[model samples]
Target chain A: MGLNLEFMLSIIPELLSAMVITLQISILAVLLGIMGGLVVGSFRVIGPKWLKMLIQLLVDYIRGTPQIVHILIIYFALPRIGIILNAYWTGVVALTIIATGYEVEIVRTAIESIDKGQIEAGLAIGLLKRQILIFVLLPQAIRRIIPPLTNELTNIVKASAFLSVIAVNELTKISNKIIYETFYFFEVLILTALIYTVIITLLGMLSNFIEKRMFSTNSEANS
Target chain B: MDISFMIEIVPRLLRATWVTLQVSAISLMIGLVFGIVLGVLRVYGNRFIVWCTKGFVIVARGTPAAIQIYAAFFLLPRLGIRLPLFAVGVVALTFNTSGYQVEIVRAALESIDKGQIEAGLAIGLTRWKTMLYITLPQAVKRMMGPMTNEFANLIKASSALMLISLYELTKSGHAIIAATFKYAEVLVLVALFYFVLVQSLCKLSAYLENNVFNFGKTADPRNEFLN
Candidate 1:
């Protein structure tokens, strides 16, 4: 009934293995999100009128709902609509959709942050729209955007824990399995949480370091 | 997309929306109180309390809210800590939201100039008095904008309460879908409940951001989407 060291030791091995699935889903989701966000965000920022409106509407719809709702909808609702996604695809697709909403905002803001004069200079130098974006705006925006984008990546990692409810055998669900078997509820949950804390905090520290370095370099280059 | 089904489910969902808000509202008030305390402690308490509060935030931020909900709902009964469903929802959500709100408040407090406190002491104010009178009011005003954003997030997050068999808005939609087999229609309408709630929250956040910064000075538009 009390904290069992023996049970804790036994369950850790299982939890660590389950953590692989958690990382697998989160990393995959984030990668897909970045790619999707780059394309969609770029288009939304500078694309034609109708496409911008369409993506804007889609982003609003995605933004309004919670991540848990998205996972539930993807897993349950899609099958009825004659689309079947396996657990892996479901995790990737759903989390990517949510990630893209935030990532697009990050990218849009990053692009918008570039001074308008830089764009004018690029145009004056005979650069095309794409060349101006790629050559003039993106380099600066990438440095500024790293912190928020990393923050979103941490969000995806946390969101992976929700995938347990859909029986994804991620870290949280694996802990639930251990809890039922060992009745070490408190020990198991704490241990599971510690792993996530370590991962997310490391990412946060990395983002802070990047932001600080970028800030100093930007200031230096300006001077 | 199944308008008749939506019409039929609307009333039931609306009723559950109140239940959901009750959970969020109660938890948010409790969480805000806890947040204010923890926020101050993190900023000005002795090293131990500050460190302990960091541990609390670490746990809250690291795991999913569902895990907290599960521990509160399922494991506690086994631990001889029995609570009603509503109480459990409030406890779990409040615990989780406090972890976040404390960060918001602490950041607000940190942004204040340290020289102001030194100035207060020069004017014969005690350290506690300096904090209470000189620091907290400004922090709370700036806190309101981010606080509203967190409150809106809290409401949206309350949807996770569905897992523990509580009929909050998200769960209410599931109940309707389970009975009527109108999954798409019920979910669409359910999404509408959330959309309207979040949009209103954004408006409130914008209002607070504009009107609450400084001694009624406007916030910088460059940082408008910041939080």
Candidate 2:
């Protein structure tokens, strides 16, 4: 059968409402990811050799495997270890873990991107290491991190769709349910895909704008 | 928790890993061909052609791979073009891979020095000839690192196929868990399989970077470990 535009239009409200859950889970993950990433990523750079190595192994394990497996581990396997989480919490934990892994890398690189000369200047001015880190390094690093951090938001949004596998009732899950009932596969899916495209494309544009502004201001400050 | 159950599923898990690798490899190979064409068109085609390629990339990238897989699984039957689930997964995965690969290829192509193309033209090589003989060879080298990243991404993204019950690595884990309810044991093995597979690809790419593509240029530090 042909696409039913009327049927597709009818489901928009339901799908849009479910979009809230998608955003909620993604935002939670991104928030947790930033905080966790900042803490762990800093340790990765400046902590003891053992901490660095430990973080290395964590990053390798998380990055090397698929997120689906992580979901299974957190949602399914963790119960065996006596830690239980519902599907929503499981989705959040899984996405946060994924986000934090990348965020850790981003933070580490952002911190590294700060010019050593800047640190030396802080020292030349008699600033303590802590002061240099807090006053000089982090300020610059935060500016550098924002663009990639914004990019990561889009990644988290896309990753949230995986929650559908666990019946998380997010936008994709809602759409899948509708498709099953209506048999309007093309219409429902195309609309769902459109919603995702709009969300991601907007986030991507914002990232580009921020990158341009950050770099331009950076050059101006340097000059 | 069941050590014996985990041991029992090793053979089946290994077979599923084979499926995972096969799907990823086949999709990536096909994707490379389409990506090259789209990347070329994006770089050199008329406005209409460029717009089409850009639109394809946007939709392919913007939507989730799971949605794409579902669309393939569900919509293909309506067109009277039904395929097995395995083929459907590959179709969807290839479509997804080409979108990302197009960007890699485009970036590689654009990074080629303009002067070289001009020199080729000055020596009477057509624009197409220059692209074929000079630009492509150099671009191919530059694309290798990013392409390696894309393949790793494809392998991970292919896990979305588990949603379609394609009996890939992750799906196999789900199957075993269903049969035995030993989620912990089955999934650890599945994750371990994917971990080793992706790590080996990363290591292989590193070796290629060091030995073959060694221009003495360092790789991007940000992507060094993250990808």
Candidate 3:
């Protein structure tokens, strides 16, 4: 089949509109995931024994299962418990749940990587556990976590494609819609991939820049 | 809410577990074969082949597997190449895993010391013979841990099969949930199945770490830097 430049150009605007929804879902999910990760990560490390085990189990389950299945469970199953969310919210919630699981491990590892002496120093200074966690542990942990956290964000962006399965009108879903309408499957898919590649590439570059800056600064301070 | 309904669904889900295992096992085997070949090619092949292999790895690694499955399911049929849902899932996953596994296997091969290859050559072995006899055996040993992790990853990733309408474990759980509307209960069970599978793999990794990959015991200075 001959390429339809005009048709493709016209669909660009619709696809661009859908990109907004995709970005919105990714960004919101990442934010919720990061927040959830902090809570769960801290709980896993420093919370009560039972809570730590529960959070650890949650993280394992999330990491072990596929995002699509998690989405299906959240979207379809939640309604049985009287929690009826729209597709977009369902997508975000489910993605957040999965993301949080992975992110907790990232955060917990970051926290663990912080020098134990620093925590001891905080205790030596008469800082309470809460103060030490809030001021000292979190800052260092967050700094160490920037790289992995960025990676998790990129993963969430790619994973947001699963939202399309539930008809959330994200970029991939929109591309599917266009393909269904125009019957230009290759063009639509290639275009969709290009969009994703561009966005993810930019995010990757930005994260690398930040990682270098942080590490170099840290090294300079240490030296 | 109904325990009896979940109990009724268990037999069906257990039967569907066979499909999940089949897809994971077949895809893992195919992916490992392709991964090792591509990985070795990337290391030992000429420049053009290396570039082509790199390109394959990059594209496969860069995109989501779900999109790959969707593309395969929808696009291949347009070219009069119709693959069954299970075939599509396995092929998509094999392609996906090959990309990542190429890097893993390549890294393991590269980690082997150069002197071993030269020693084999000194013994009058041809390059290919030396590679097969000297390099691969050591590389395979080094790859044991990573390969185990990759197998676990394959099991987890096979959950993507559900998106393509393959009635794997996750899909089976969704099927049960559809009838019983016990989303939380069914998902928890599904999650437990995944946990048991992955945790067993993790235990296997730990065992390999302790018993086989004895670098842990040596306290080699490399461990300090690596840790």
Per-residue CA lDDT of candidate 2, range B1-227, in tens?
68887888899999998999899999999999999999999998899999999999999999989889999999899889979888999999999999999999999999999999999999999989999999999999988877887889999999999988999999988988888887777877888898898888887777677678995765544232210
Q: Which candidate leads the pack in DockQ?
A: 2
| lDDT comparison, 1 vs 2, better candidate | 2
Backbone clash pairs for candidate 1 read: none
**Predictions' DockQ, in order:** 0.50, 0.63, 0.41
What is candidate 3's CAPRI-style docking category based on DockQ? acceptable
lDDT of 1 by residue, B158-209 (tens): 8888878898999888888788776778778888888888878877787778
Q: Residue B35 error for model 1, in Å?
A: 1.0
True contacts kept of 3: 0.46
Model 1 lDDT, residue B86, Cα: 86
Task: Write model 1 residue lDDT over A105-193, tens digit each, in one string.
Answer: 78887888777778788888998888887787778777767788888888888888778767888888888888888667888887887
Clashing pairs in 2: none
Between candidates 2 and 3, the TM-score winner: 2
* Sort by DockQ, top down from the best: 2, 1, 3
Highest lDDT scorer: 2
Number of backbone collisions per candidate: 0, 0, 0
Q: Which lDDT tens digits does candidate 2 get at residues A94-142?
A: 9999999999999898887776788778889998766777787778888
The per-prediction CA RMSD against the true structure, in angstroms, equals: 2.9, 2.6, 3.8
User: What class would a CAPRI assessor give candidate 1's docking?
Assistant: medium
Writing each residue's lDDT as its tens digit, candidate 3 over A1-223 gives 5667777787888989998898899889988989999988877777766777788767767877667778877887778779998999999999889889888988887777777777888889999777877898888788778887778887898889888878898998888888888788878877787787777777877889989988888873222
